[model samples]
Structures are given as C-alpha cells and as structure tokens.
Target: MGNGDNCNPNWKDASFSYYKYVPSLAAAGIFTGFFFLAFAGHSFRMIKARAWFLIEVLGFAGRAVSANQEPGCWTQPPYLVQTLFILLAPALFAASVYMTLGRIIEVVDGEKYAIIKRRWLTKIFVCGDIVCFLLLGGGGGMLASAKTNKSAFDLGNNIIIGGLVLQLLWFGLFVVITLLFHRRMMLSPTARSYQPDIKWRSYLHALYVASALIIVRNIFRLIEYCQGSNGYLMTTEVFVYCLDALPMFLVVAWFLWKYPGEISGLLRRKELYDGSMHEI
Candidate 1:
C-alpha cells in the first residue's frame, strides 16, 4: 500500500490516512461478540440498556467489515461506516451509564441525598449525552466526508474535540454528584437504603467503576484527536483496542454481571406496596 492515490476518488487528494495498519478482524469480532452478549443479557430485563448495546453491536460489526479492507484501498461507504459507527458508539454506552445512576438513586429512595433530584438526574445527564452524541456523530461524518479539503478536516477534528471536552465535563460533574450522594447517604441512610433487598451501595460502586472507565477512554480519545492524524495514537492500531475497545467491553460486562434489573424490580415492588398502603 504505497501512498499514491486512494481507491476512492473523493479521498484522492485528502491528506488523511484512514488506518496506519490493517484493522484487526479478530479484535473487532471479539468486541462485537461481547456487545451482543450484553445486549442479549439485558434484552429481557433492562430494555433501554439493551438498546444501547445493540448500537454497539452494529458499530463493532461495521469495524470488523472495515478491517477486512486493505488500508489506503478503502471506499467511501466502508470508510464512513467504520469511522462514524466506532466514533459514536461510546456515547450511547455513556447514556446507559447515566441512566443506571438515576435508577440507583431511585432504588435507595435517596432523592434528598442526591445533588440533583432523582426525577431530573437522568434527564439532565442523558440530555447532555445526546448533545455529545450529535456532536461526535456530526463531527465524525464531517471528518470522513472532508475528502480533499484540509480546512474542512481540521474543522471536523475541532468539532470532535469540543464534543469530547463537553463529555468529560459532564462525566466529572456526574462523578461529583454520585460521590456527594454516597457521602450523604452514608451519613444519614434512608429507610429503603436499610432494606436487605436494596443493594444500592453496590450499584453505586458499579456506577463509579463504569464512569471511571468511560472518563479514561474519553481522555484517551481527546488526546488522540488533539495529536492529529499523524500522531502516535492514530498511527498505532494497538492503542485503540487496548484503550477504547477493551475498556468499553469491560463496561458492558460489568453491567451484565451487576445488572440494573435489580433496581427496576425493587422500584416495581415499592410502587406495588405504596398502592396497597393507599387502599388501606
């Protein structure tokens, strides 16, 4: 693969190199399988989480297909498919994590302990997640389609960085809120928090683990984009798998092992008990 002309005419004059090496089909396959497993695990219980996992499945599948193509010989469609899907998939994962924290707060009846009201916690964070999603997806599309226009490519990279920075800020705020709630709950536990059936603390711990991994991944990406296409991070295929792929897979696996369905079940039971009390 000599650096002469790209197979796609659109990228013929583009300075950007899509991949430094052939993308690893094995890596893509493994990650895709893990995501599918997570999706199946959550499908019957946590429908919303399952939806996000489904998108991850599609993203890694696209990556696998893109990997099969030789570098510098990629067509426009495959390039866009891989770039856009892989770049945007983590945002969806973040959305699920945000909702999990909201569910945890509800399960513990820790509304007063939380910095943000339980009713608004998911809404605020998920809305921020949506904005990050659009910024990332739109920026990725721009980067992929910029073609021969160097200025356009730079612009796209800048947009992606902006999105990443915003995501980091939101994640930081989320962690602070979770810690504050955890501290308050410990100092003055709610009645529900004492219930043997409610494992809210364990769930909060899981949220911390998940959120930390995401924050690390986002920081890696922010650095990668800031370093530009020819930077070491982009030139090395190993970093993507180790930093982005592995961490994200662990996140899904963690959620599967510590499923949020328990919280949902507890909430349902609480609603039923309250209804019965009202009738009495």
Candidate 2:
C-alpha cells in the first residue's frame, strides 16, 4: 500500500510533465505546417497563393507554444514574440482567404460574378493585409515588451485594437462585395452558365465557412486585446481556447482538409481553354 503512491506520478507531476512537453508538441505542429506548405508547393505549383495560409498555421503553432511556456509573462521578449505571432498570423489567414476568393472570381469569369476586376482583387486585399500585419505586429511587440506602467501597455493594446478594427473593416467590405457579387450572379441572365460544378461548389462553401470562422475569431481577438492585460479575457485561459484557438483551428483544419491545391489545379486546367480564367 505504501508503494502505491510511487507506482504512478501524482496529478500535479503529470501536469508538469505535460506542460514541459508542450513546446515540443508545438514544434511538431509547426513542422506539420511546413510539411503541408511543401506538399502544396510540390503538388500544385501554386505556392505563391498558398503561402499566407502556411504562414498562419506556423504562426498559430508558434503562438500555442509561447502561451504554454509563459502563461502570463508580460514584459518579456518571449511575450512579444508570442503576441506578434498570434496577432499577425490571423491577418495572413485573412489574406489567404481574400486571395482564394479573388481567384475564385477569376475562375468563374469576372464579367458575371465579380464586381471588381479579377486582376484587382489580390492587389487590393493583399495590400490591405500588409498594412494590418505591420500595425498588429508593431503594436503587439511594444505591448508585450512594455515594462513601464499601465499607460504604456495600454498604448500598445490600443494600437493592436486599431489594427484589428481596420482588419474587420476590410473584411466587412470584402464580405459585402462577395454577397453583392453572389446576388448579382443569381439575378443575372447568365446565372445558369456561371454555376460551378459540384466539387467547385463544395470548395466555395468551404471558403465561406472558413471566412466566417476567421471573422468570428478576429472579433474575439479584437475584444480581448481591447480589454488590456488585466481584463477578463486576458486572465482567462478558457476564453482564449474557446474564442481564439478554437475558431482558428477549425478554419485551418477545414481548409487543410479541403486542400486548396485541388481547386487551384482545376483553375489551372480551365485557364488553358478559357481566356477569362487567369493563371493562378
């Protein structure tokens, strides 16, 4: 009976062991993302289009490890890196979403389905994404590294909120355009001609779900950062897991499961015959 306790580790010790292994687990996740990136590049040859998604996945993996290692290590360089990776990573996912949507528009023929010219979709949304990334990255770095009083931290948090708000605005516009385009197509004479095949339609639905998931996640993040470090959202791990981590994981998993490479391959094939379908 006395040796029973020694037969197995206590709960606390088991937890510590799990915690200690988290960084290695996170590294494995990052490696998985890199492997997927290479897979997409090798299989589809559309590496340029898939780059943002890979970045986002790797970023999320990095953020997860950082969070586990330093639950609340503010004022530390690791904190800054963690915040930057998590904060900026989603913006990259959004960029990938935008690129995918734009390319879809091109695939369907811009004249009937898209409002903006196909050529302009990537240019506009990606440029906006770049701006958001800079703002969030800069702001998160400052906030995490701030050793000063509350005001300095608040300043950094505010800047992050600003960037997030800007992203929401940009995404809102994109959604509006997408809806309007869909509506326009539904009402047009060429509606029947524009309907995608079953596989393509499935891809479109996947994108829609992915976009909605990301937008919801971003909203949570915007609120979390706006609350500052001492805020309820920041102090609570549950909220972070449910709101931030869950949504992103769902979105990324959905897309990865769908594998955009298949869609891109179709687009490439179509582009050979259709003058309107631009090269991916």
Candidate 3:
C-alpha cells in the first residue's frame, strides 16, 4: 500500500500497473486478426501455417498483482482466465515456432530433401518447440498468480524472470538457425532464384515494425522484474496500456496481414525456391 521508496524519480508513481487490461486488450486484437485470416486466407495452404500463430492469440494474459504490495486487489474478474492464457501461451508459441521453421525450410530447401527427411525435420522442430513451450507455460502460469503474501509474490516474480530468460534463450537459438539458413540459401546460385520468392525485403519492413513492438513490450516487462526489491509493475494502468500493450498488438496484426500475398503465391506454385535478383 505504499510507494516503497523507488530509487529513481522516474519510479515515483505508486499507481497500479496496467497489467491486466493491456494484455487482455492485446489478446483480443490478435484474435481479431486471426479470425480475419481464418476466413480470408482459407483457400491458401499457408492458412495452415498462419493457424499456428492465430492460435497464439489466446495466449496473451497477465495478472493484477500489487507487486511488492502496492494497493487494492484487481478490480477486474478473477485471475483464473489469465492463468489459463499464460499456461496455454507456451503451446501456442511453440506452434508458431514450428510454423516459422517449416515455412523457412520450404523456401530454402525446396525439393532437396526426400519426403522422409523433410518430414523428420518438421517433426523434430515441432517436438523441440513443444518441450520448450511446456517449460515456459508452466513457469508463465505461475507468473500470472499474483501471490499476495510477500514471500509468495517474490517467488512468482522469480518464476517469471526465469521463464523470460528461458524464452530468450530458446528464441535466440531459433532466430540464429533461421537466419543462417536464409543467408546460405540466398547466396547459393540454385537458391538465388528463390530470392524473389522470399520477398524478404518487402517483408522486412513489417517485420521490423512488429519486432519493435514485441521487443519493447518484453523490455518493459523485464524492467518490472528488475525492480525485484519491492517492485511495482502496474504503475498507472492507463500509462502501461498506452505505452506497451496496444502498440504491440497492432504491429503484430499488420505483420500478419503482409503475408497473405506472399504466402499464397508460394503455396500456389511452390516457387519460393526458384527465383533471385539476377542483376544485383
């Protein structure tokens, strides 16, 4: 129920954090985009690919904990729904990871691998994603608990931090592997033609925007965790929502929207592996 002597003037605010509302709103926005894809992108094979991320919309959730005991309990509904979302988020995230890898393989490897090997890689990636997701989900669910007792709250905070660390590790590995594969393909003469298929430069802009949103959101979350000793996350719910949540969701939606054309073309002709910038 106190400000807890924030170290910096910037941390002076004692208002409740926007933990609950922001995330819930972002989830809704993501779901709306998913619904659009399900209906509009239905005919395209990439629809299945997008399905992986669409399902992820349900994963956005958080709790209304008074970090280090700030003020009143959450004015919203019970924390149960947020719990479910956090627990389920890892699974959805894993699905997206698998989808991303699968799409990349289709673009880079093309007909190089036999059916068995291709299928094997897909399964292996998916399995790895699943395992990682489960680890994240279990820990993430604990994060949404908002334990009131000081000891319990601190424990929950630690769980969240640990989960974030694990997520960064796993995601970093995937990003590295994917980028290397993309680079190798683009450089190879055979795969050069596929460059046009990638349309990466076109997609890169959207990716940057979406990434900025997600990265900022995650960084903000990390800041909350760093305030370990008498932390105060949801300071001024409105500020948190405006600054971190809505922007992230909107960027994500736009990113997804950019894919329908490229994905549809790739699925129709399987030409993602057959084009390049010949003159450049």
lDDT of candidate 2 over 1-280, digit per residue (tens) = 1123222243223311111112334543654465456446444544544334344445445445544542222123433454576567678778878887776665566455677777887799999999999888877777755644567667877888999999999989888887777666556624323545525455567777887887898899988777655557665556755676667767766776775545575577666756654543
The Cα error of candidate 2 at residue 123, in Å, is 1.2
- Name the better of 1 and 2 by TM-score: 1
Residue lDDT tens for model 3, 38-138: 43543353455444343323333223222322333332232444444533444453444445455545554543422324556567656765664554455
> What TM-score does structure 1 among the candidates reach?
0.90
State candidate 3's TM-score.
0.58
**In candidate 1, which residue ranges exceed 4 Å CA deviation?**
1-14, 44-52
Backbone clash pairs in model 3 (N, Cα, C under 3 Å; residues 3+ apart or in different chains), count: 7
Error of 1 at 135 (Å): 0.6
Output the number of the lDDT-best candidate.
1
Residue-level lDDT of model 1, residues 169-256, one tens digit each, is 9999989998998999999999888988888888888889888888888999999999988788987888988898788778888877
Every model's TM-score: 0.90, 0.73, 0.58
Off-target runs (Cα >4 Å) in candidate 2 are: 1-52, 55-75, 189-200, 274-280
For model 1 the local lDDT of residue 28 reads 85
> Best by TM-score, which number?
1
